[model samples]
Target: MSDQAQSTTMTPPAPSDFDGRRAFGRAARIRTPRTSHAVWSPPADRADPVSLLEEQATSRVPDLVPVRHGRMMVSPFTFYRGAALLMAADLATTPNSGLTVQLCGDAHLSNFGLFGSAERHLVFDINDFDETHPGPFEWDVKRLVASFEIAGRHRGFDDKDRRAIILAAGRAYRERMLAAAESTVLDAWYDHLDVDTMQAWLHDERQAERAAKRQVKTFDAVVAKALTKDSMQAFAKLVTTDGGQMRIIGDPPLIVPVEDLLDDTDIDDPEKAAREILASYRNTLFASARHPLSEYTYVHMARKVVGVGSVGTRAWIVLMRGRDELDPLFLQAKEAQASVLERFLEPCEYDNQGERVVRGQRLMQASSDIFLGWQRVRGEGRIERDFYVRQLHDWKGSLDAEKAVPRGTLLYAWICGETLARAHGRSGDRVEIAAYLGKSDAFEESIAAFAEAYADQNEADYQAFTAAVADGRLRAVHGL
Candidate 1:
């Protein structure tokens, strides 16, 4: 149909009493559980996973690509985290329910964690949004559940234990989605797993009063640590006063100052570039959030590479000092690219990839960073990139794998599942999702099976990745 004909159809919207419940019933007629997620098998024509990594590397910093490879080479868990593009490609062929939401394109065990909410409370949510976009919600859940299956291998877990964790994560998602569906819109909006609330929830299971008090205190300290870790933390970690003026201490290929990166290019005027780019970022924020930035002045910035998948991305950390020497804030500006899902799904609503991250984050998270914003970089001669900026760390800490006991892993799975459900509920039709999930556990069980099958595929991919590195096709620098 032509555009004018399609417009005419919308002008006379009297399609026999349409409503949300009826719209949801209509979605149920699409994908079925057995065909949707149960059957999982790799195609004969599956693209080489390493080639996908190579394709992604073309857009990243050339030198840092080796670091990304090295990180993925560490273990299957790390490999899964770094191979989001590979998985995205695979998921494109999988059966989707034809429902879309703001997806965390790289959802995995390591990607969900603790961050300070705008109210200064410790909240658990998806902490990364580099590839956030509107796509099938199951893509996020499948990646999340599969992460547990892959990580379990690193911990020397048996198939039964791995299956149990996968089921636990999937069940949590199903149950939470049902709860959100039954809740009032306001309740769903307010739902979040904050530190204090979590502590209270755990209280009933505690034995001794004194021991429980100590545990709560320990949790409090962990949350408080994020507040203390600010610009001074970045200052001490990334720079030092040497030979007259302070400078970002070079940490080889990982932490290269942008000045070293550009030489005597337009970046030679570092302060001027910082001022102009920062103004662009400030304009992206809400008026209230933008005003507070005026209290601080830019001190220094360095290209600080971070995360297994994110190692090669153009990420810069900036330090801004406030009224006094003690008052400092650290902000991160990371490069944004079109989401991996864009190839299979509709194009993103926003033109700027950075805005896609920021807006999608606000829609999914219970609360967002007050300083969250975006900027477009315009250098000489077609040098342009989009970046999203936020505080480097605001009492932010992630659960360590060292502490992943069977009991703790179960709890972590629930936390991740519940948080992910909340994120989807905020942007998706929870009622429809809950209905599709139904009274049975078939959908959850199918995902767990898919997780196991995908875990096997991940191991195979890991082997290929290592072989390429061994043959010198890929360069990997082991250890930091």
Candidate 2:
């Protein structure tokens, strides 16, 4: 661990008085005033953004690095999606209130989405945790608010409209955190926002008109579509019958079957190796011998490229059948690397990176996938890697931010802000955070200003990234 990590890991004093905690939060404003968040001046010795990306590519699969680059090159918004490390480095230079939380370290707009909770209800929450780690609360706020600015610019929103959208999100977070501070601990813990609530809110909030009706109808369709996206849906799309057996389809750079990737020399028996991997993963999910996972028999496994920043990382989809061929279960095992925030903040306490992600997700979300678990796997040359496993899809969906109008984007931002605040309040001192924010627009307006400035920085970084690709410093395969 770095010295910084060691310093930050010191235990905070235990709580004694409620007013004292609020005083502590208010005192933080003097140390790192809300207005200090508005500035964004790059240090002279700052690491080149492209260089940071290149360093990350070193650990990834060489063939898929270009694909990752391709996705990020689509727009400044896309580049921002892949530039968590770049921003982490930048954020480290900013002043913080020392109010720490379990951060969704890459908490951009697209990362918040709808997914089925264990109760089988579609809930809206932070959907990505690959970079989750303990960090300053403002780090997540900065990332999220800035995403709206970047995305707003992409959609050609006017300056006034963009600022309005960013303010709406910031205000939502502050108000939600304040509300959480007033509630009983258990009540706050149990708080969650589901899709049904969102739909109802839209009905109550929207003006009764043809345009509003169309927007509601569109969102309703998105929810309907998400409901159909489960294991059975994946089974119909990605799995096919091969002679007398079932197997995952091969789509070279995106999805390649395990057998296609490993020859006889790589492993004595590919099927046996896949089964062993599944068995090891099963142990992480349950202690009971008669667990539901025990009923499923592994049939096939495939390496799949996934996400904007996560493209080159090793991700695999495993196919299993319970009882019969028609009863399918798809599990995704994704490699978990050290969080991008680890270098800037404290090192994760969990030795297993996968466990770090799993624990963080469980702590930060109101409800999580039942199959969420982690394990270590040994590859060729005995190289050990950590991986977190979850259902491949259980009503997973995200708002189409790219296609949304200014009004729609503003409301979406409000929802994302509320969701993020709930996640933060779960693991952080809500009283202090709420007190620090107080009843003022100072923090909200400062964050909007910071977001606008950072969006400029992101665009400059995006230009440099594109230049690197043009000059062959980086390779990009577009339209992947």
Candidate 3:
């Protein structure tokens, strides 16, 4: 076996098994005593973000090479940016006064976005979950706050403004957690941020943030335009007739064709194994009448390169045709594996990692992809991985934090806080957590300190990544 294959076969340490309530108790233990404790100090002579990023990349689970390459090439900053999973693990070890929740494992700013709901309304919430599992609620809050601090710095925000944003986020989280704890479980489950509702909330605050509201409205438009069927024509334009057959441009490691990943498949073979894999996907589709996807007919499938961190992973875009050419459905099948969060979470009863993600997402998010499900496929040596299917793109969008004003940052922080609180409300110790956060700004300041320190670590990792590339220790396929 190749070195990579050998590593994949060796199981990593299984996560600790703490029930949600007990987990919160452990976290609370750390936070309660620390209520008067000074902020956790960062390592002296901290590594540059670039170097820290490189070290984190080396630790990625083996089955995700495709995504890893794309993540690496996004820029030293972006690579450092994508290393939140590494940061989360490190932060979990810090001295805590036991504040915890069910966290969105990857809670960086960019992870929040808009997606269509069952009602077809565009709703905004957390979007990625490759690293999601149960852990301290504070972990998610800290990560979100820290990301804001780092991103604010990247956007040239002054330290004062960055601190304000972090504080606002913490306050929002604390308040929202308390509010949700008082709300009915079903009510919280049904809650979501539609555009109009978001606008109303902003306007009601009378917070002098008109520009921020306008920006979110503009973002909604951009996402709608980008995800439309006509927009896919832009994708089709990238295809060319090669020997009279339409094919996507082959940009190695990024836009790899599905044929490249499969062996012994000739251009003339109509029923190649990869094609069979696509055929198998149809069986996994949600039942007709229940899922809008029933109307779609399998048209074609291609390996799509996606996300800075996921660029090198096996990601496929499955296109389905409806009644007419204008009607189309796209489903993304990104390979899933044990999350870095799994290193901290207890082992689950389900065998498939994709099932773990789907279950976790459903548990944490107010709503989830209607088609969210998992399946096992025959990979090298019958390796079992996971796959969560979702609409490829339906009015999906996010804020451009680099250009966002202070008001926008504050508003985004509020939304994130509220969302995190809702998730935490589902846990066992909401009463104690709500009490600990206690309408005070101290926790916010502590989180800001943590973010600043961690962001430094991210930069260090990024630098190390570039150095590794320069020294020929790692390979990168750039400019895809």
Candidate 4:
């Protein structure tokens, strides 16, 4: 096996006794009853959520920190997306099944999306790994289900509809885990949710309910749009030509070219420094006689602000030209910090934070970007930081929760639940997790209740956040 494969692989030993595994799971209920999952009252000594955000901001780029606050302030759902740290603390107070999984630690609804598989087929899976770490499996489920609840409230969905949507996700997760438990080890490992399968699932839902065909049309439209969102599309949208030299367009705080940032800096030769960093990153990729990345030569780079939670820490878009300018590759080198879950659980195994993300992603994701790699670079103040690199856009697409109708959102929630189960089953004991969940809806109903309670907590936290910004405790530039 390759070194990368060896380092990241965490396959459990072949189960000698399925009944024993299931018994262990069932026994866990005595220690932590299934109904206990519904509880979500904050501890008396709970840390202030706003204070945690302030502490986190100290390590990020100062100027971009407010942008993160601004993005989070958009709505309670948005605030929930950026408050993984706050939620991680709260989840620590809850009861767990003790069935561990390689979690997509920030598995909010927005984090589950569509991306191109290595085979070029578009597949839906967890797309973010900023805080990925092994912990209680239900932690991911609660975060995902609660996102639907919070989002449903944001869209003015009735309480009944919101409860149904949340229940769909919880039920789907339980069913999928049970199914994985019955399957062979290899079968569970090979499972993936491709676009064709996704379309079929949606079609079946529509056929059973005799719902509008527009859902199918929406699925097709999303798939079509995703296929067009490859690197070529990114190049077309982000690159500009100046004096016959292609360069990343400068859009200030959002996208600043390297030259602009290096103007008065101590870095003597900016391009040379950039190339050296690129060369170090290249070594981290799958190295053969000639790696695929070696085909591309470094051209230009820019610092870019990206995503809701990932706004502050340094992120850069590196431009590479393969064959010529027409054939370009855009790689995003995003900083990787200690996971939000780290404080609550055990520390990460990988010393390099970037490797922690890449490895966790490989363990949970059925398919990953080919260009995925990690490197540590010393920048500006000569301080070294870890960053994981991947293609800026590889047929990426996402559902806009704000615009999705109730039926569509419910269907998407089911898919997200199934996707999360497949991910968990890969790394955790499928038989154990499945047995813990059982054939009953006890766990599912409990989680749905927890989602509702957490949504209420999120609204309270959002209020405190906005208050901080209003009183000048936190700076926020709106409408970015």
Q: Which candidate is the best by TM-score?
A: 2
lDDT of 4 by residue, 192-299 (tens): 999998788667854657335877788888889988997789999999999989999989889999899875323556688778877777776765347788898988
Error of 3 at 55 (Å): 8.4
Residue range 156-213, candidate 1, lDDT tens digits: 8777777778888988998998898888778988899887787676565653442355
Q: Give the alpha-carbon lDDT of every model.
A: 0.79, 0.88, 0.61, 0.88
After superposition, candidate 3 runs with Cα above 4 Å error: 1-31, 34-38, 41-77, 96-101, 203-205, 209-253, 264-295, 427-429
Question: Where in model 1 is the C-alpha error above 4 Å?
Answer: 1-19, 22-30, 206-227, 242-246, 264-268, 288-290
TM-score: the better of candidates 1 and 2: 2
TM-score, candidate 1, is 0.90
Best by lDDT: 2
Q: Is candidate 1 or candidate 3 better by lDDT?
A: 1
Model 4 / residue 102 / CA error / Å: 0.8
Given candidate 3, what's the lDDT at residue 41? 51
* Candidate 3 TM-score to native: 0.79
lDDT of 2: 0.88
Q: Candidate 4 at residue 117, lDDT?
A: 89
Q: What are the per-residue Cα lDDT tens digits for candidate 3 across 1-480?
A: 112111111121222322343344334444344343224454554335444445555534343443565455565446644676566556545554444345667787788877766566767778887777666566677778877877777777887888788877887887876665455656655666676677566556575444455755665565566455332563464455567554556765445566665651122332254345555544654563355555656655666767765544456666566775456556677777666555545555468767666776777666677766665556555544457676676667777765777767777877877766776666434655665565566666667777777767666666666677677766665555
Error of 1 at 79 (Å): 0.7
Candidate 4: segments with Cα more than 4 A from true spot: 1-14, 204-211, 263-270
Task: Give per-residue CA lDDT, model 2, range 357-381, as digits (tens).
Answer: 9999999999998888888876666
Candidate 1 steric clashes: 2
Candidate 4 has what TM-score? 0.95
